[model samples]
Target: MDVLISGASVAGPVLAYWLRRRGFFPVVVERTPRPRLGLGGHAVDLFEPAMEVASRMGLVSALREARTESELLVLERPGRPAAELRLNAVVPAFDDDKHVEILRGELATILHGVTRDDVEYRFGDSIRTLAEDATGVDVTFESGETRRFDLVVGADGLHSRVRELVFGPESEFRHDLGGYFAVFSLPNYRRLVGKIVLHLGVNRMAAVYPVRQTKDARAVLMFRSDTTSQHDHRDVAAQRELVRKTYAGQEWELPRLLAAMDDADDFYLDTISQIRMPSWSRGRVVLVGDAGYSPGPAVGGGTTLAMVAAYVLAHALEEADGDHANAFAVYESRIRDYMRLCRDAAPRVLRNGVPRNRVHRAIAETSLRLLPRLPDRVRSRILAGGISGALSSFALPE
Candidate 1:
């Protein structure tokens, strides 16, 4: 079968890899002009199941070597002494042999490296329109080229063009969680080595961690808003202004972090939202990863979910012997409950991570401070019930 997968970041490549391994030809279309190798983004966690998938693909060692190696976390509050904690203790799952946290770009580069030689990648292009018939999908590219494929997979992210073209407008399915997340790279002036520094405030948080294998660091700023912004996601200047206005006069390295944005080349800003859909497939077209069912960005384990979903999708297709109807049905059935759990848990995760008031912030801090001192069994239970557990809850098909 000839399959055209949109978006080459995470799900597309993984789906392409597994599909090719199962005797199918997969072509990937990416909007970026070139591959995003080493173009640093946010740090993403890979839970047990994702790690197992990596192990199966012989990428565990490489992923481990590329991990951010953040050993310590420093929590800073204005007019209060900074509290220090071991990063692994803060999230015990990070200490587990099954979990690895790496830069998003690095993970993408690694995944692409394994699939490039075997897959056809068309960079600097995207689907302009998708016309699906009983036999195949006719895809028109923005560059004006047209092609037909037996199947078209929309692995494109939250604002997926493919999904918009087929499923309707994004706003129809996107449920805004009332927050924004922005990240960019800057010089490692703080000289933070193997450490992550978080500046917490009511309704807002800023964090910086060093990028492995470079003298650079990544700055992440998040804030809650009453309503979702109407700004275009691609408007960099407008996004920067929004961030600046939201974070203006903040304390503890925020001024410097905002200043550093002037020189930051890879700025990304998006609403923290979830994609909820009744169906992920229509005829010869289907959606995967963030394109179909993103719980929420940053707060949710989106990276891990994307990986596992892609793996399941390719496995389902192979098991069904190229019967996309059966395969898409199986794929949705296998992951729907897991997706629901993630989606339902996301609001609480966001509320905890970005406290709305002083009381909430204090409660969150106290919980973190007490988490490590708990008994081993108690800590394990807590980890199993929290975001870590929800992310790793899925059982991959044999």
Candidate 2:
């Protein structure tokens, strides 16, 4: 079978790897001109299942070496002493060997490298239109080339062009989680080494964490908004201004972070939204990862879910002997429940992370401060019932 997958960052490449391993020819179309090599993006977590998938793909060693050594987390409030805690205290799952944390760009580069030789990657091009028929999918590229494929998979992220073309408008499937965020890299002015400093204010927060080397650091700024107001998703200048306006005149490194955000080269801002769909497939076309169901960014184990979804998709296709109908059905059935569990937690997390008022902020801080001191069994029970547990709910098909 000849399969065309869109958006090569994480899901596309992983899907390509598994499909090729299943004796299927895979072609990947990425909008970016080239692979992101050590670019600045937030560090993402991989739990038990994603780690298992990496092991199967022969990428465990490389990923282990790429893991971020974030040792401490410092939470600061206005006119208050900064609270210090171990990074694993806030995220207890990381204390175990099953959870791995690495930079997003680094993970993308690794996945692309592992599959580049086997997969046909068309960079600097994208599908302008997709016409699906009983036999195959006829795709037209932005560069004005046309091709037909046995199947088309949309691995694109939240604002997926493939999903828009095949499924519907993004607004139809997008569920606003009531916030916005921006991520960028800056000079390590504070010289933070294996430490993360977070500053929280009413309805906003800033997090600065050291990167692989102590020379540079990654900054994340998040703010809460009440309404799902529309903004240009592609306008960099506009997005920057929005961030600047929203975070104007805050305390604890706000001015410096804002300055760095303006000067930073790789500034990316997006609304924190989830993609909820009734079905992830339609005839010969199907969706994978954030393209189909994104339980918001940052929270929800999105990257891990994307990798496992790609693995399940390949196995389903192979098991069904290229019957896309059966394959897509099984793929959705296997992942729908887990995806829902992840999505359901997004709002609660968003509210807690970006508190609306002082009361909420205090409650959030108190919970964080007390989480580590909880009895091991109580914490285990809580983790098992929360988003972290939903991450490893599915076992891969052998």
Candidate 1 local lDDT, residue 307: 91
For residues 81-196, write the lDDT of model 1, one tens digit per residue: 88788868756567655899999999999999999999999999999998888889888999999999999999999999999999899989999999999999999998999999
Mind giving the per-residue lDDT tens digits that candidate 2 earns over 195-228?
8898778889889998864478999988877654
Q: TM-scores for all candidates?
A: 0.98, 0.97
What TM-score does candidate 2 reach? 0.97
Candidate 1, clashing residue pairs? none
| Among all candidates shown, the one with the greatest lDDT | 1
Off by over 4 Å in 1: 93-96
